[model samples]
Target chain A: MEQNLQTNEEIEMQLWEYIDGSCPINDMQRISILIERNTLWKQKYDELSALHTSFSTNVELEQPSMRFTANVMDAVAATHVAPATKKYINKSIIRGIAAVFFVMLTAIFGYALFSVHPTTGTTSMLPKLDTSKFNLSHVINSETIMIIVAINIVIGLVFLDSILRRKKEQQAVKP
Target chain B: MELDDTAVIQMVLQGQQAAYATLVTRYQQYVFTLVMRYVNNREQAEELAQDVFVKAYRYLADFKGNSKFSTWLYTIVNSTCLSHLRKRKDETILLEEEKMVSISDSNQAERPSDKMEQRTQKQMLENALKHLPESEAQALTLFYQGEQSVEEIGVIMGMTTSNVKVKLFRARQKMKDILQSRFSRELNL
Candidate 1:
């Protein structure tokens, strides 16, 4: 009886593997032969087959709301968009630009410093202008200054509003 | 030919944001069903599922495409549900609610006299599924419903392939035991 129980357990394992299509061909053939010869093996196989059939047929996929995709897209739009290319700004490109800018700035500053010789104690290379020739009053009016300030304030407020709106939209989407 | 998941992913990565909608629509029902296995709340499951898609979009660049997209997506679904379950940790309430739903279903089934036997058996199987440990139930569901191979299920569930096979075997055995006991009880009734 104990040996029979062990055999039954082994048969059950093989039957499961067979159902899953994981059993080797030779072992499957052996199980098939056993099923034909043994009443117990056939009964177990039939039961398992019925359960497998029921599971495959009756189990239905649960669906979400019709707006599920739309909601996801909206959430995506509200978030920061990823760059189109995987390498949006290559590190080498940025380094090369910075190197060029550094070299140009250094050369300009070196020339400016050397053009004014400390031994001569003169700023001859620098362009000279009459102080009276340039007047802030002639170039700008109080109204123009006020308009520039107002435009800056408006731009700042617009930027701040957009940032706040994005924050609110993100909060709304969260479960 | 229609675009495959990899092609759609490429499009999304290339800044064609609308391409992501195809992915969401294709997998919404699948992700929702997988989440429902753990959450058991339709509304919460839907929310979590949407969150899954949003996370996927945010992290699309991180996907190296080593595995199938469905396998990778299911990994996200598994982790999301796990964290949610951790926070909620209200198993008793959820089980009670599920029992109520089961009772209501059986009551409705009893009314349809002609199909009573079929409906009762189906309901019994469902209830037996509920009685399973969450891991076992999930394994069984992924195996049968997702049509996932053991290795794919291992990727989703974070188990070895052999472990997944063992779990599937035990889950089936437990389900059979539950059904047999329920059948005997119904006969006595």
Candidate 2:
């Protein structure tokens, strides 16, 4: 697509995609033409091309210490290679967890169903249930749910803030 | 002859432990460099990178070679670094862009006019990458140096392919912005 980008950011974005060679063949042709014809486009493309070339040619990978491989090998020797997670992860434990969850779900359904109170008079062949006796209004009314939802929203916002903001001072403390 | 990763892995699996070192030697720089993106200190990054290799070795049996070895290795690196950062979440690394100060707020403009111009293109690009968010920097590095496709980067970084593209775009802009502002005289921009 011929992107008539307005802002510098948008223009750079298109140039980056073009330099990365990810754009379609037609878009690449159009971008090539624009780079050749348009002064602004040429400047942007040249700068971006330099950046792309530096990434490939000029940038050097950070090398580890000479003993890095040896240290890793030493650790590997100390511990078994391909340590199967199966050794530590117990299938029985997983089955136990599943069973617990199953029991909990069954209890919840049982409580929901068995909480029904039989009516004094039968409406039909089956006895009528006084469902009103089980008032969910006290348990899950709009106000309570809204409060829970608000609290959740507040928690989510706090978490997002924490992720976005990094406190530089305390970063040295190792984990 | 240098064996491919898959062949080396197969040899290692078949009781040829020495062959595993070849894989480590090949990828040590890459793993170390990527780890340094999250943890800047050489000592800490080296430790983490070493642990990543060990962990990869431990889980070597599970690497069925369905994906490229580099992709699998990078996936491990991402998880390892992320988990390490999470462990010390109370004191995790800072996002340079999210700092309280911006380039304008800082004394970048006050430096000698030739200071930025004196820097090599490599050094300028390195500084720019340092200022980018970790994931964006990683996306750029993996794309150019790691020989990873956008889809592979997405898989490694737990982002969508489009999200990887967006990150790369942002990274390019940020790099250009940084360079243009810092070394305006050197670059014709």
Candidate 3:
């Protein structure tokens, strides 16, 4: 009788866990004792079990709408708009052109430094005395470097003008 | 051919943006229903569901494959629901009180008829669930959803397995009393 009472109390305490099939093995054995000993409790448990089963099987499933997928895709597209193609082209193409110009200017300076020599001091006798200020060593060493730098400055100004013009055109065209 | 969740996640991490759409399509309904259980409003549920997907996309890189993808997704859903509840502090209490009052009023004025009794019972159960403590309501719903093991639920809710068992017991009793009383009261038994 005492054992039966203990089983009944255990069953009441762990009834939901038993119904869920989540009761541990030891608890299961104990609850099974109560089930066998008391037919009323077993009947009540079975009815409740069936009720839960009925609820699960009969629960309504909700589908958003036929347009749900399309709506989501539309929202995604609307949010992350693709920037204009001309903007991309202006960015990469202009930067590439500028980079090429700078590299070419550097190469010209290098050639002047290593490959060209200054005219001899035989020309120093002329009245064009700019040559008086320039020695062959200094002229040969510095002329190419200075000319290459000047070319780079001019190229930089030209590149800046083109970039500004392109940006202005883009802004102007956007109505 | 269909790829598994792990494969889809890997593809997404490799910068395959389209793979994300597949993940969303597969789990959107499940995620939406889970959100609906919390917010209980269809439109708000939809918005929260979309927000959850966007968040999952953003944090897909951090999903380390330690758990199933669904578990990770559920963690995100649970957090999103909790955050929403926190933001609208009185909204939950108001919904519960509304449900309780409606149930009480319907009980007093209306005769218990046979034809719509099942519908009334279901409504009563839902109302009772709305009136449950937030933790108990969530625990019971997650249990019935059948997506996770008791251990997994305990992990999700940061409760002990025994504590989850006890809470579920209370929730079921509450449901049982509500359902039984609805029938008995209607028939004047």
* Residues B1-189 of candidate 2: C-alpha lDDT, one tens digit per residue: 778888999898888888889999999999998998888789999999989998888889887665788888999999998999889877866755554256555436445275676787777677767777777788888887788887778768877567878888777677767767776566454
Model 3 whole-model lDDT (C-alpha atoms): 0.67
**What tier of docking accuracy does candidate 3 attain?**
incorrect
TM-score of each: 0.65, 0.74, 0.61
Q: Tens digits of per-residue lDDT for model 1 on A48-109?
A: 88777766776677879899999999999987545434467688988999999999999987
State how far residue B189 of model 2 sits from its true place (Å). Answer: 5.2
Alpha carbon lDDT of residue A43, candidate 3? Answer: 72
Ranking by DockQ: 2, 1, 3
Q: For model 3, how does the per-residue alpha-carbon lDDT over B1-189 read when each residue is reduced to its tens digit? A: 999999998887776767777877888877776777687788888888887877777677677665668767877888898899889977554555666576567556554454336655446456556656666676766666636665555656666566777787766665665556555553222
lDDT of model 1, residue A137: 93
| Ranking, TM-score, top scorer first | 2, 1, 3
Residue B154 in candidate 1, Cα distance off native in Å: 0.7
Better of 2 and 3 by lDDT: 2
Question: Where in model 2 is the C-alpha error above 4 Å?
Answer: A1-7, A83-128, A132-175, B95-97, B100-102, B107-114, B187-189
Local accuracy by lDDT, each model:
0.78, 0.78, 0.67
Candidate 3 chain B has its poorest 10 consecutive residues by lDDT at B180-189
Model 3 clashing residue pairs (backbone): none
